[model samples]
Target chain A: MRTIFYISDGTALTAEAFGRAMLSMFPLKVVHKTLAFIDTEAKATAAVNKINQAYADSGERPVIFHTFVSIDIKRIIMSSQGSCYDFLDYFVTPLSKELGIPAQPKTHRTHGIQEDTGVRENYDFRIDAVNYSLANDDGSNVANYDEADIILLGVSRTGKTPTSLYLALHYGIKAANYPLTEDDNMENLQLPKVLKPHRHKIFGLTLDPQRLHEIRSKRREGSTYASLPQCRFELQEVEKMYRREAIPFLDSTRFSVEEIAAKILAETNIERHRF
Target chain B: MRTIFYISDGTALTAEAFGRAMLSMFPLKVVHKTLAFIDTEAKATAAVNKINQAYADSGERPVIFHTFVSIDIKRIIMSSQGSCYDFLDYFVTPLSKELGIPAQPKTHRTHGIQEDTGVRENYDFRIDAVNYSLANDDGSNVANYDEADIILLGVSRTGKTPTSLYLALHYGIKAANYPLTEDDNMENLQLPKVLKPHRHKIFGLTLDPQRLHEIRSKRREGSTYASLPQCRFELQEVEKMYRREAIPFLDSTRFSVEEIAAKILAETNIERHRF
Candidate 1:
């Protein structure tokens, strides 16, 4: 099995994220390990030793993905016995040359609430959006419908709540979701009275009947709500409503929440309030 | 105002995330722009011209943060008229020397789900954790208490929901939250019967009474639950209880959900199932 080591001066999330995505494309069994907070030469050396040992054991050079701003630590780790993919080095050398200036190597500057006013304001906006999405979830507060940046309309278990939360937290988009119920009448495919005025902001989610059934079964087993027929009927009717209203929609059966959120943002042209 | 450009081969999320965190340390009015999907030399050259124009217009060196794995694209972007900090180049050159293998520069190997089983497994785990968190939020469903990776206990508006959701979506941790209701007497500081069995997995969240009051006031303006006196009483009692139980806790008033989740994972030694 191939071994992958993610090394970084900070939490190593960027290295791990990129490495995982890359390794996923390769057809091989992989063992992944992370060496985070490698901000010093000693720590980098220790990480290198561990990676080297893994390489020796496997009789093949282990893959090392790293993100280090500190040149000293970066150098030490780079000298290790592995096939190193340095995230920092591959671009910074050319950049420094062009800019006529060296970058200030700083650590732990990836994810946090910074002490800057603009960053603070952005964080607060995200918090507000997250709270707003939670409060307005599952059609909880229809009175605030006008304030929503985008409204997600779907049947239960169609991946509405998670998508709404993802958009709100990540992009600072005021996303509110409403679940279509049996009361709405599947055969009629009519928009709810409360959603008619806000139809322009609506996005729909649909999924395969079997997939929807499997998702709902985990939550409420053996119930009609979790049955394949119920899932099929709801998805079919909801999709019909989407077509009838000309509301943009996507199938959530094969997409993760990140992909679903990205698609929604792209399709809706919704303004993201935060970086 | 200063200008900041986040350039990347992929989504530019890493460049933006790190750049934002670093810039937060400086007190400046900055306009941030993201040039994503810069995998081609043409795209890189176009981006350089835009940066040069911005520099010409502002008469100031614009800051550019970038991550490009393709050497060709990286070279073009590095020729920009800006203060460019390349994330990839700062280490890869040395890494190539140590490994005795030149780096194979590729593009867009970050921030998306791949077709491989390992990547799909991680995505499935995150989605499951998110759904689990949502279903178990606010102590709503206690039947699956044993399945939680961590439990958060706090008063109303101490940010239990968002933190739980963040942990689930980002780290693939099955997090559940319980709100300390008025029914749980504060002065006595007794552990509730439901939580006693899961005390080892519990993490407490505390917030400044003023912040709690403000957060709640937005939800329920005139209710006693949102009153400053009520918030103060609950907070003081919760702290006392936390001290008695030796439950690790964090003050949510100061830190963002990301920070809070990171601390919880670190302090609790909770294994994150995803990168």
Candidate 2:
């Protein structure tokens, strides 16, 4: 039988999860569907009646599936002549039994923001906003090093790439990171040659040397880069370079994603246009 | 005090909630934040260490934040130095107050062939798999439609916009939606006019009459468009068209966002490609 899925007011995450689930949950046939989104319960109930009548007229008993935050409306659906009585009962039964299941822990609306938009806009905005801090390097997109938002300088295993993407995605902040390698990093001297002019834009990512050693070892065990002394030396030299250059740096040792983000914002004074 | 935030593991939803909270609840500014998606507690600890040391080196005590499935890790962060200690307090305090703050409900990871990726290099693969559906409309960009993993078609209030944006931002899916208005919708009384040539490419969304009436009332109260009687009439007419046309649709009345999405994927025979 064909099915109609209804989702009343809530974030779109549940819808996405369901979309992903539908793609792989069934045997590729006998599953024809429509996905409708309603912003309120009154609208959802109205939709159920129309679907029930349509199925009844067609001489078929279709499964009018639904999921939502409340059970008050299930009565509305159940009362419909052709609608199933146990709509919630049927859906939640097996769902509640699944292993590794995490109960939908209720949350305060204050902590949540019902953003109508998504991350792409924010990501694109930040990436574009920090145009002033960017600089040019060997065929790289660097210009005069004046357009960068926050430039990250760190030795290997210091977490740069993902951080760059995240800043772009979540904060709408453009972040460019330059790696400090063994040659210059070991001497504790050279920064990215092109980055020298824009040293003020640089922020050193300092970490405990031993921690760097562990991270490298896990990725490429037994390699020289993973050796404890190698990490220790790199970290020490990098710290010294940061100190000598007077580049403001942060220690990320005990911050949550939230705390670190807060600190960075506080220090840099970069204003976020939208939360 | 510029901070780098990291997510070691669990549902990024929790971390994401906290991120949003930080943006709103405090005076913190966000610089660069990264989520290295790890599934379990051990991997989370590993991520924390990498993040921790980076914070450790900054002369100023930086917060290294971590959110893991384990209560132990949560405890560790609560007792950790710097502002990182605040996370445990933030998460638990709300829980203690019985708030519905955790958007990622702890649900059992269930069965079904979920590893399937929806991307297809060939048209035949899409048709055979019945995974990717297309949407046709007036002067729509091929760049938008052709790249779409899923396309949604329904009347104005069928919830196409939010669903499309959600899929795009979260799953990196290219999604396009077409409005089935009174004119276009009626023109396709026997079948969706635009969808005729690409019938296999269409996915329909329809709501019950009462629900539509209520929804429409919110925008244009006490008008023909929002009247209960008009809603009943329109819903009846629409259902007749759906049945006469033999179109597939989801009731959209009782389904949660997750359940409806699941039905759609199942019906469409699409798969998810998640990293």
Q: Can you write out model 2's per-residue Cα lDDT over B10-114, one digit (the tens) per residue?
A: 334344443442333233334445443455556555555655665676544444344554456555444444344223333333332322233232321111112
Q: Each prediction's DockQ?
A: 0.25, 0.04
- Residue B146 in model 2: shift from native, Å? 24
- How far residue B225's Cα lies from its native spot in candidate 1, in Å, is 5.4
TM-scores of the candidates are 0.79, 0.38
lDDT of candidate 2 over A106-218, digit per residue (tens): 32122132233333344335434322212221114656346566677787657553344345444656667677765563764666687788777677776677767766786
Q: Point out the worst 10-residue segment of candidate 2 chain A by lDDT.
A: A130-139
Query: Tens digits of per-residue lDDT for model 1 on B1-275?
Result: 56799887666776776566455334446777777767688878889998998888888788888877666887788788788775445555664454455665542355566555565678778889988898899989878889999999998889898899999999899999999887887767787889889999999999999988988898899889999998999999999899989999989776777768766765667888776
- Candidate 1: misplaced stretches above 4 Å? A1-11, A21-28, A34-108, A208-210, A216-237, B1-15, B18-28, B35-109, B208-233
